[model samples]
Target: MGERLAGAEKEVLVEIVRFTQKNGLKGAEGGWKDFLARNDKKFGASVSDPKKRTKDVLLAFLVTFSKDFQKYFRKLVRRHAERRAIEQYMNEFSGRISPEQKLVQLTTEHLDYRKNYYFPSYQEGWKVMRIGKVSSSMNSGAMLAIDCEMVLCHDGTEAVVRVCVVDNKLEVKLDTLVNPLKAVADYRTHITGVSKKDLEGVTCSLVDIQKSLKKILAKGKILVGHSLYRDLYALKFDYSRVIDTAYIFKYANLPTTSTASLNSLCKSVCGYSVREDGEPHNCLKDAEAAMNLVTAKLKHGFNDPIEIAENSVPEPDQMKLLAHRIPVYLPCQELLKIFSGNPSIDEKIDSRIRGEFYSTCISFNDIDEADKAFDELDGQETKDSSGRLQKSVLLKRDNGDVAGFFVRKMVYGSRLSNSEVLKKRPQPTENTEQKKEDANGDNRKRQRTSKKHAKKAKAPVVE
Candidate 1:
C-alpha cells in the first residue's frame, strides 16, 4: 500500500483495475467484488445500516463532487500521504468507501470535505468521464435533455435549486425544485426563478434527482442538454453519452471553444426566446428548447446552420462578498455598536446561523473596518455589559481544550475572505537593515562635522 501511495499515479481506483487481466496482468482469483469484501473495513463506513448495505440501496448514497471539492480532497490525500512518510497511517476506513459514495460524506466532516463546494457547480463539471465512455458504446440512439438551476450556499458554493428533464419527443419527464443539503447562499431568483418560499417544504435531495435521472437513462444512454455537462455535474451523476446543444450549435463569428446559450439558439434557430430580458429562467422551457434545438440539428444532418446568429452570454457574478464565523454569540446590535454605531449591516440584523459561537457568522459592508472592530471587541480589553472596559478577557475558542486545532491557530477573530485576500495581497518589499545602516552613517557624519566646526571656532578664539 505504501509503495502504491509512492507510485507515479496515486489514483487508488485505477490500481484496483490494474489487478485484472483486462489490464494485461494475470487475473486475480476474485475481481472487484472480492476485493471490496476483503477491504470492506477500509472503505466502508464504520457503522452503516445493515439494510442500506444491499446492492439496490447503492443508489441512495451516490454523489458527484465539485471541482473545488475534488481539488481539496487530492490536496488532503497528498498531505496524508506525506504524513505516511513519517510513519503516520492512512485512515483504516478510507478505502472501504465505494466511488459512488465518495460524495457528500462531508455532510458532517471538515477538511475531509474535498468532495464538496466552492465556485458553484455550473463551471468545471463534466470534462472527464465522457468521450472515453462514448468510445466504448458507439450505438445508443436514445437521448434526453436535462437542465438545472442553482442557488448559492452558505459556505460560498452553489447548490441545485431546480432540475428539469425533457425527452426528444418534446415531453417533460421531471421538473422539480431541490432542497439544498446546505443552507442557501443566494436564491438567484432573478435568473433561477427560485425563491425561498418555493423550496420551503421541498424534501427532494440530490440523490433523489440522481436516481430519477438514472432511471430515465438506464445505461449507455445519450443525455442531452444545453451545457448538459454542467447539468450532469450539478446532478452529480456520471453518464458518458451526451449531446451538448451548446456545443453542437454555434453562433456566427464565434470560436468553437465558446458555447452558445440556450436562449440564443432558441431565438435564432428555433425562432423563439426561452425568456424575456430580466426574467427568471424556466428550466423546463430551457430543457425543452435544448431538445428542440437538437431536433433541428438532427433535421439539418448535424451541421451548424450558415445563418446562425449570435447572442450574448449570461453575465458573471460581480458581488465579491465574504463572511466571518464568530464562535461566540455576537449579536447584530453589538456588531453595529462596534462598527462606529453605523447601520453597517443596513439595519438588517438577520442570521440563519444563530444562538451559538460555532453557528454564528457575520459579514461586513466594509471588511477591513468590520474586522478592525471585530478584533477590538474580540480582543483582551473589551467593554463589559455595564459599559466598563474589562481587561484579561478569556479567548473565544478558549474552552479549556487539551490542544490547539492548528499549528498557527487564531488567538483573535478573522474573516474568511479577509484572510484569503490578505494572503493574495502583495507585501511591500523593504530593506530595513540597509535603511538602518544608511541612517547610522548619516548620523555619524553629522556628529563628526559638528565636532570639527566647534573645535576650529574655539581654537581661533583662543589664538
Candidate 2:
C-alpha cells in the first residue's frame, strides 16, 4: 500500500474531510473513534505504539505538516493489510536493493499447523524442530525462494528427499538430497530424481537441513515460493514469512479463488519458463522461476503481469437441488420419512456430515419426479426432535439469514436413470353440474333470438 495507497488514501480522506467541513470537527472525530473501535482487533495490533487523538493531531494532518504521522499511518495500514492479503503486500526489484516501503513484510508471529500441516496440530511431529523460522532481531528485506521434492515414507506419509533454495539474484544457495529417517516406500524417482543409488552414501539428514534453514531464514527474513505452504509442511517449519507466487499472479482463465501453476505463471509473467517439456521436476529451476515471477510482478508496478482488468473469469454454471431448512439434530431415518410415500424419490441419502444443519441429496427417478418433489419440498422446514411446523424438503433459501443444502443434480457426467415404476397422475373428470348449466344457457339464448325475429318480421317491414 506504500506505493498504491496514493489515490485510495485521499479517496478515504476526502469523505472524512468533507464530512468534517460539513458537520465540523466533532462529527469527524466521533466517526474516527467509532471506526477505530470497530477495527481495533485488526488494525490496532499492527501499531507498535498507541497514542490518544488530540486537536493538535487533526490540525497537523489537515495542514500536511505531519510527515512522520503520515508515514506511520501508511505503515500501519500496510502492516494490517499484509495480514489480510498477500498479493499487494509482496513486491521486489530483481538484483537491486528494495526500499523499505516496497519490501514484502510479514507478521513476526508463528502460523498454526491447522492450515499448512497435513496432520493435526496436537501431533508431536508437526514441527520439524523447536527453532522458529523467523526472529525479532532480523528485519532484512531479503528473500529466499525455495522448492522441495518428496518421497513416500513407510508410514504412508511424504518425506522431503530433495531441497533447493535460490536467492533473489537467482543464485542457488542450497541444493541437496536428504536421507529420510523412515524407510522409503517409493522413491518416486521419475519425479524427485532420488533413487536407491542417489541416497547410497547420503550423510545429511532433515535435522541438518533444519539447522541450516534456521540460519538462512532467521532474523525476520521472508521466504518466497509457489504454493510455499506445501514446502513449509514438507520441511515441517511454521515459517511466518512467505510470498507465494501462486497467489500473487493471475492466469485469468482459472478459477478466481484458485491460482496458476509456477510454470504457467513464469511463462506468462516473465516471458519464459524454467522447466521445459518432458523434463522431470527440477527444484533449482523452480525456485528461480518463483523469484523471477515476483520480480516481474514488481516491474509491472505490483499489478498482474497480464491484463487482468477484464474480469473474464466466468461464473460457475450448474444446477443444484436440495432439501433445506432441516435442523442438524434431524436423523437420517426421520428425514427419509418425509420422502416415504413419494415413489419418485430414490433411496440414496447422504446425511453423514452433521453441523448446524443436515440435508441429503434427494435423488428423484426423473426430471418430472424431481420437479414434483421440489414443488412439495421447497420452503418446507424440517423440525427437530420436538414436533413443530417443520414440513417438507426445499431447494433455495428465501432469506439471507437461512442456510441451504445444495444437491448437485448432474454429478460428474452421469445421466439420470429412468424409473420403470413411474406412476402417472390421474386426469381430471368433468363435473355433472357444469354440463347441466351449459344446456340451460343454450335454451335461454334460443328463446331470446326467436322473440327478436318475430318482432322484426311484423313491424319493421312497413318502414
Candidate 3:
C-alpha cells in the first residue's frame, strides 16, 4: 500500500538499519552522513537535497523496520528453543544423556532462563569461596556475606555495635552484639535497632568477635556484600576476594564518581526492594539482601565475581598539614588572615555551605610549617574580642598529594614568635669571599670614603 523504495534506496536502507542497531539512536545522525559520503554515486542526483532523501526517508524506514525487527527476533528465539527441544528428545530416545547434562537441564528448567546466562563455572565458584587462606582441607561450597552496624561513641565517633555474617544459603553464620571500648554516647536506636538496654548485658568483646570472624572467613570462600568498604573499615579488617553488588551494577551512564545504592540496585536488577517498611535495620537481613542480589545477577548471566582490593584510607605523612574545626561561614580573605604574619607562606582556600553544615579546605605553603602550626593550634580553643569561642583543629590528609590544612573556623591563636617559626631563607655558608662575590659583583666597589676638608667644615658650622 505504501510507495516502494528503489533498489539502490533499499540497499542503503539496509546498511542504515545495521548501523543503527550497532550504534543505537545516539549515533544515527552521524552514521547517516557517513553512509551518504560512502555511497555518493548512488545518491549523486539527490546530493543537493540530501536531507530530504537521507534523514527524512531513513527516519520513516526506521520507524517501520523497528516493529518488524522485534517480530523477527522473537521468531528466531522461538526457532532456537524448538531446535534445542528436538535435540533433547533425540538424546533421550538414544539413552545417551549424561548425568552432568541432566543436572544442567534440570537447573535451567527450574530457573526458567537460558543456560548460557553468565554464571561462574563450578571450579570458579569454589575458588571465589576460598579466597584468603591456603588450606587443602577447606570446603569448596563455602561463601560469605557480611554487614555491620555502628553506634555513636562519647567522642562523637562511630563504633561497631553489631555485626552479621551469612553463608551462600543465606544461613546466619554469625550475628552478635559488640561491646565498644568507649562509652556509648548514642545507641542509634532508629537505624541500628540497638538500645542502651540491649548493650547493658552484652559481653562479647571486639577481640573475641574478630578472632571468630577470621576463622569463618578462612581461605577459599567468596565474600559478597554491598559497599563492603564501610563494614570492613568499622571492623578494622583487611580482606580480598569480594563481590560488591554496588560495583557490579555501577552503570556507565551514571557519573563515574558515584556508585548506586544497594537498595536501588536490588530493586532495579532483582525486581525486589529492601530497607523499606519503616523497620529498624537488621545486619543479618542486610547481609541476606546482598547475597540475594548476587544470586539474581548470577541467574541473569553475570558470572565473574567483582573482586576489589580493600580500600584502606592511608594515614597522612608527618610532613603533611591538616586544619579542621573551622566555621564554614568564614570568607577566604578572613581565613588567610590567620597566617598573614607569615608572608613567605602561600595558601588556597576552598569552602562549601550545605544547609547548616559548612566545610572548608585551606592549603598551606609547606608541609613542615603546616605540621608545626597544626600541632601548636590543634585543640586549643580561644575567645575573640566579642567573647565568642573560636575553635580550630588540625586534620590529617588521607591522600598526601593534596597538601593542605582543613579548617572549620577562621580564628587561630596568636602568631608564632620569630624564634619558634623557621626562616624561609638559609644562612650563608662559611666561604666569606664567595659569599661577598655572590652578594655584590666583583667590579662593584663600596663608595664610602671620609674626605679631609677642615676649612669647608668650619664654614658650614658658622652658618
Candidate 4:
C-alpha cells in the first residue's frame, strides 16, 4: 500500500535477497556494507547514498521480500536435496536392474513421497549423476598387476627395495627402486640382482612410494599378482581386493598347504616359461607374466589344468614316477609278496631306507593305471606276527602328486625294528662334552685378552 518497486529497484532488490540468502545477514559484520559497495556502481544514484536507500526504500522492500526470499531459498534447497536423493537411490538399485528393463521403478511411485520425483532410466540416470567418472584426478579403478623385489635388511627381515605396477594391457605404470628405511644386510643378488651400488643414489622413501601407489590404485581395484599377500605385507598395505595367481592355480589334487609355483603354473597353464633367463627376477616381467596367465585363464574360461594334463595321454616310458612310503620293519620278502599280487605294481619300484621309514618310488604306464593301483592298495591292511593290523597309506607330494604308500602300524607308529630304533636314537659322547668345556675355556680367554687390550688402548699417549 506504500509504493510499488520500479523495474530497476526490483532487480536490485532481487540481487540483495540472493546475496543475503547465500551469505546470511546474521554474524555478517560488514555483509550489508560489502553488498552496497559492490552494487553501488550498478545501482548508480538510486543506491549511491547508503543511509537514504536503507531508510527510505530498502527497509520497506526487505520487510516485504524477507518472507518471499526465505520461500525461494527453501525451494532451491529442496530441489538440490531431491537431486541427491535420486542419485543415492539410483546407485543403490544399479546392480539389481535387469538388462531388458528400459526404466527402473522407484521404491515409491509418488515422487513427492520419496522426495526424488525425477526418476530416469538406469543409463540416463547414471549419465545425469556422472556416476562412471571419479572426482579424483587419479587413475580409474581398473585392474592392475603388481610385483615387488625385496632385500634382506640388517635386522634379517625382508624389506621391499623395488616395486612395479602394470595395467591389464601389460603397460608398465610404475617401476621404481625404493630406498630402505634401514641398512641392507644382504643384496640377495642371486634372486633380486639388487646390490648396494644400485641403491647408492636412490632417494625414493617408502612413504613416497605409498603416495605414488595411492595415486595410481583406486579403491575396489582388483590387484593381480603371484603371492600378492607377501608383496602387500612387504609394502605394509592392507588392500584386500586381489586375484592371486597362486590361488587360481592351486594344486587341486594336493592339500591346501600346497601351491603351484608361478613359473611352473605359467609353463603348465599358459604354455610359456617365466624367469628362466637365469637373471634375477624382473618385477615388470613378472607382472606381465601374471597378467598373461590371467588373460589366458579368462580366454579359456578357467578350465581345470588337471583335466587338461590327464587328457594329453603320455607314453608309458614318459609317465612320471610316484613315491610311496612302506614300513621299515616289513621284510623285503614280505614286501615283495604284497606287491606281487598287484599286476599294476611295476617290477622296478625303487626303495630307500630312512629313520623308521622305508620310501618306495613306483612308476606306472599312465596316471589312470597308477590311480587304480593306489585306490586298491591304499588303506589295505596286513597282518603281523602278533595279529595286529598294519594299514598302508599313500603319500601326497608337495605338488599334490601321490606316488607311494607307507605301512602304518596301529600299536606303534612306525615298523622300525628294535636294532634300527636303537641305532637311530641319539647317543651322548665324551668328545661332545669335552668340546663344550673347550668352547667355554676359549671364550673366557678371549674375554680376558679383550679386556687387557681395552685397558692398554685407553692409556693416554703423549704427542
Lowest summed lDDT over 10 consecutive residues: which window, candidate 2? Answer: 310-319
Q: Write candidate 3's Cα lDDT for 1-463 as tens digits.
A: 1233222244344433443433333233244445455446666333422224654555444444344443333332333444355355536543444322232233334221221121111111112122332222122335688888998888976788898999878888899999887888888799899888888878897667768777887754566777775676566654444566565542422222234556555665666666674567888888998888767766665443221111211112222332333444333344444442241322332212233333444444454454455444433344333332333333233332212223322222223335423342245565989777776763343333234543323211100
Name the candidate that leads on TM-score: 2
Model 3 scores a TM of 0.38
lDDT of 1 by residue, 1-463 (tens): 2222223233332322322212222213243334344547665543232222543222111112233434433433343343343221114444443221121121112231222211122234422222223222333456677889988888986789899887778788898889997888789899898899988888998878877876777754567777665666666665444566665543433322234567766776778889888888988888888878777766664344333342234322001111223333444333333222132332232222233321212334444544354334422333222222222222222233221010011112122244554563444456998788888999997877887675643211100
lDDT string, candidate 4, 115-212, tens digits: 11222111111111121222221122356889999998888778888999988888889999989879888878888877888888899977777777
Off by over 4 Å in 2: 1-114, 117-122, 125-139, 302-463
Candidate 3 deviant stretches above 4 angstroms: 1-141, 302-463
Question: Estimated TM-score per prediction?
Answer: 0.41, 0.45, 0.38, 0.40
Which residue pairs collide, candidate 4? Answer: 323-403, 323-404, 324-404, 324-405, 325-405, 325-406
lDDT of each: 0.47, 0.51, 0.49, 0.51
lDDT for position 458 in model 1: 26
Which pairs of residues collide in model 2?
138-219, 377-393
Candidate 2 accuracy as lDDT: 0.51
Lowest-lDDT window of 10 residues in candidate 1?
402-411
Q: Candidate 4 — worst ten consecutive residues by lDDT sum?
A: 120-129
For every candidate in turn, the CA RMSD to the true structure comes to: 20.0, 19.6, 26.8, 31.0
lDDT of 4 at 166: 89
The Cα error of candidate 1 at residue 299, in Å, is 0.6
